[model samples]
Target: MIAKELHDKTPDQLRDELVNLKKEAFNLRFQQATGQLENPARLRTVKRDVARVKTVLNQKAAAAATDA
Candidate 1:
């Protein structure tokens, strides 16, 4: 879940991870809305993780574009 780990992954893998994180985030929001969320703090972590994944993905894309 760290930027260094994400940087080592291929773009496809990063995309997949991003998809999964987004799904988790959606589910967390739903749980919060229903007031059934056990760990409300999880929502914050998931949101940050999503942002981290996005940042890494953008960095990878920029690197590729410059390489071309």
Candidate 2:
């Protein structure tokens, strides 16, 4: 997913996406540990996606706080 797409989502949706990404990241790590990971690049992609979601979430929160 891209940051631009994420920016269009509501905070609740972003949170849900974040949760899903984290779960995937966990699974990816487990697979790596077991030497069963098919694509090592996927791990990096997930990690960056997680960061993107988090950055968007933080930006939303900050904007809300400023508005309030």
Clashing pairs in 1: none
Worst 10 residues of 2 by lDDT: 1-10
lDDT of 1 by residue, 3-65 (tens): 899889999998999999999999999999999899999999999999999999899899999
* Per-candidate local distance difference test: 0.92, 0.96
TM-score of 1: 0.96
Query: Candidate 2's residue-wise lDDT over 1-68, tens digit each?
Result: 87899999999999999999999999999999999999999999999999999999999999999999
lDDT at 2 for candidate 1?
76
Scored by lDDT, model 1 comes in at 0.92
Question: In lDDT terms, how accurate is model 2?
Answer: 0.96
Best by TM-score: 2
Off by over 4 Å in 2: none
TM-scores of all predicted structures: 0.96, 0.97
lDDT of 2 at 42: 99
